[model samples]
Target: MSKTILITGASRGFGKLWADAFLQRGDKVIATARNLKDLQDLSDKYGQALLPLQLDVNDRAAVFAAVQKAQQHTGRIDVLINNAGYGLFGAVEETTEQEARAQMETNFFGLLWASQAVLPIMRAQGGGHIIQVSSILGLVTLPVLGLYNASKFAVEGLSETLATEVKQFGIHVTMIEPNGFTTDWAGASAASTTPMEEYAGLRKAFSDSATPDSFGNPAATTPAILKLVDSAQPPLRLLLGKVALPFAKSVYEARLAEWDQWQEVAHAAHG
Candidate 1:
């Protein structure tokens, strides 16, 4: 059966790829972005299968309204893919409170709001799925991307807790940890706050290393995403790309080791 999937940030990158993939597979997609024009071409191409809408996930009221509208279009959303996020690259000290908060607003709170809005509809329908497009940085922190890393880390925790909480309601949550993809994630279109002058050297190095031109093609991960969407029992976490998989594994192993190393002392104190 064809499913109704609502995807945020559908204007570009993995979001656009996911929307196209789902449409190709005969799924009904309610594609949304801050600027609907970016999705206009897609809407023209896919017709009814792709319902394009303007959505700024950061706005709580807008998110609620959008989800309500989406539910009206499909009666129920079979899947909600929270793909709207931005990358903030800078050292912790270089990033301003406002900049960090803005990142959290879009990447963390935006996702939270969207999920909250959709949960009621899904619960009423008895089951649904939520896919969060997190990053490998969500699992591991790297230099110069502290703010981005923080957002993803928060998403990782939120998704994990949500998975457990929604299971009884027959709703599923999956977090996709993707590595570098050939998207405008680091080109002229990428989002970057003004870096502090003190860290100019580090920021320049990061910019050179993390540009979108250097990443692998985004098409590589679309298939995996479509597969996860269609699967009867998708895992709580889907690590995309070869690079992301190993990095995620390393993070998990290191976390486990650290926990194990502290377990004895932790338990002794409690006892």
Candidate 2:
């Protein structure tokens, strides 16, 4: 059966691609972005199949109103993809408190609000799926991306817990951990904190390691997402991209090994 999906951040990047893919698959997509103009072409191309709505996920009222509109369109929202977020790169000490909070508001609380807005409707309709477009940073940290990593880590935790909480209602939660994709993810629009004079050396090191071009193609991960959407038993967590998959695997393995090596002490400490 074709599903009705509401995707946030549908203006560009993975969100735009996902919206298009869903439309191509005959699924109804309520594509949302901060600016409706950003989705004008898609709206023209897909017509009624793509309902472009302006939504700042951080706005609770806007999110609820958008959900109401989407529910009216299809009477049910089968999937809610929270793909609206951006990275803020800087050293921990160099990044301002406001900047860090702004990242969390969009990447973490934004998702929380959207999910909260949809839960009631999903409960009334019986079931739904929540797809969180997290990142490899959710599981592992890297230099210059502490703020982003924190936000994703928060999503990982919330999505995991929400999965169990909503299981009885038939709602499924999936966290997408994509490695660097050839999206405009690292573009100028994706802000970096004002470098602090005191942290110049660290900032330089971070810039040297983090570049916009260091990742896989966005198209490469789309098929995997489509497959999961079509599957009868989709995984709760999906690690996408060649770079992301290996990186996630290594992180999980290393953590496991560390745990095994310290299991006795861990048990003793917990007890």
Candidate 3:
């Protein structure tokens, strides 16, 4: 059955790809970005199947308003893809408090606001799925992007708890953790704070290794996401791409080692 799906940050990157994939599959899409004009081409092609809206996810009132408007048009939203966020690049020490908070507003708080606005709608509609566009950085980390990593880590925590909390309502929450994609993610979509000379070695390492497009094709993720939407029992987390799995495994492995090293000392405080 065709569903009403809402996609935030639909102007570019994974969000745009997901929008295209869903519309092609005959679903009704409400695609939003800060710049509604960016969606005009999609609107012209999809016509009534697409409703393009200007939405800034950080605005709590606007988030709720957009969801309400969407519900009025479709009567129910079956899926929500939260893809409205950007990567902030800088060493942790290099990032000013303002830059850090701005990073959180869009990456962390934005997701939180969208989820809050949609939950009641999903409940009233009897059930739905919320797909969070997280990253492999959520599971692990690197230099320069520490703030961005922190934001996605928050998303991982939020989505996991959301999954358990919303199960009774037939709602599903899946965090889509992808490694670097061949999208505008590394260029225009990413913001860098003031660079610290002290972190030049780390910056060079990041540049040489994790420069986004160096990963591979991002189109590979669309089908997996559709699978999640079609799933009768979707997992709490869906890691995408060739790099995603290995990266996740390594992170867990390291975490296990660290836990093993600290378990006795950590347990000592439990009393």
Top candidate (lDDT): 3
Least well predicted 10-residue stretch by lDDT in candidate 2: 205-214
Q: How many residue pairs clash in each candidate at the backbone level?
A: 0, 0, 1
The TM-score values for the models, in the order shown, are 0.91, 0.92, 0.96
RMSD of 1: 2.3
What lDDT does each candidate get? 0.88, 0.88, 0.89
Could you give candidate 3's per-residue lDDT for residues 90-196 as a string of tens digits? Answer: 88999999999999999999899989999999998789999999988998887788899999999999999999999999899998888777788878988988877
How many backbone clashes can be found in candidate 1?
Answer: 0
| Candidate 2 lDDT, 182-250, residue by residue in tens | 788879449888777887877677668756556788877778888888776778998887677777778
How accurate locally is residue 250 in candidate 2, as Cα lDDT from 0 to 100? 86
Ranking by TM-score: 3, 2, 1
Model 1 TM-score, 2 decimals: 0.91
Model 1, span 1-271: residue lDDT tens: 8999999998888889889988988999999998999998888888988888898899999999999999998888999999998887678887788988999999999999999999999999999999998988888878888889999999999999999999999999999888887787766445666767888887677666765443667888777887898888999988777677776678789999999999999999997
Point out where model 1 deviates above 4 Å. 204-214, 252-268
The better candidate by TM-score, 1 or 3, is 3
